[model samples]
Target: MRTEFNWHLTAWKSLGRPSPGDIIWETELLNHSELVMRKRAYQNSTLYATFPRDPCDSYVHCGGNGNSVLNSSLICQCLKRFVPGSLENWNLKDFLKGCVRRKPFSCRNDGFAKYLQLKLLDTTHNWINKSKNLVECMAKCLSNCSCSAYTDIDVRGRGSSSAIWFE
Candidate 1:
């Protein structure tokens, strides 16, 4: 059988289980995020597979405002203008506490910082304005105090829409 596991922002490409003729399949949710699967053959042999090959592939792996630093020994880093939410946990290499803004935000004085080549966070709780361009998107987010981040709907396309995060 073929199966797929999906989340708000990402999904596993696909998983193909063994043919049913002589195999039995079982799946286990290893933790809050990881999933493991095993196939047992009638011959007393078993094959196993695990989802999310790395920490970066897990949902909210680095927590909010934390960027998963890929291709390095480092697992997470706070975004520009932000600091680790918990310095003690950060020192221990535990990023679950995520990040916090270095300075308090003031609606009129705060401005957005440009970030390039980032894999966006989960957008399940965001707002999408299809009619807004990049500039207009920035204005909208700026107008709303709750806005945290904004980006083009299609980063690699014509950018005809905007998606804004409010968390």
Candidate 2:
């Protein structure tokens, strides 16, 4: 079944105050994820910003464990040691199935993969400890059978939250 969703646009001059602008526009397309603009008397609409400025900017564009590469026809690829869950679907430009580990995880030898310069996954339901360093975080995550990913919240090398996720 096909599901329909709606996205509403609104402008605010200040907190809880609506703007009485003459025109406001926001649009999304295949090439451009989003475009927003505003217009007033005798003037062309001024574009605010174009979303997905980079191919990677689009939310989960490459699905889990996939990387979105800019300026490439083959935009998405599975991470190292992972393979497309559905190879046929991936080749057909459908990545919703995401990627899967090439081999089943072994607790005795399993370890986290270091992905640099990545926008971490959602943390709403993940575990977090503010007083842990990266080494401590890794140790904690490694001890848990369910832990899937882990990282130090602050990237500056200073002590920060240890964020961990479970599958």
Q: Model 1, 1-167: lDDT tens per residue?
A: 12475422222334564324433233444444455554444557554566778788786777778888788677898899899999999888888989899999887887888898777767666888888888889988998998989999766678789989986
TM-score of candidate 1 relative to the true fold? 0.71
| lDDT (tens digit, per residue) of candidate 2 on 69-121 | 77878889888889998999999999878789999988778677788878777
RMSD for each of the candidates: 6.7, 7.5
The model with the greatest lDDT is 2
In terms of lDDT, the poorest run of 10 residues in model 2 is 1-10
TM-scores across all candidates? 0.71, 0.69
Candidate 1 deviant stretches above 4 angstroms: 1-47
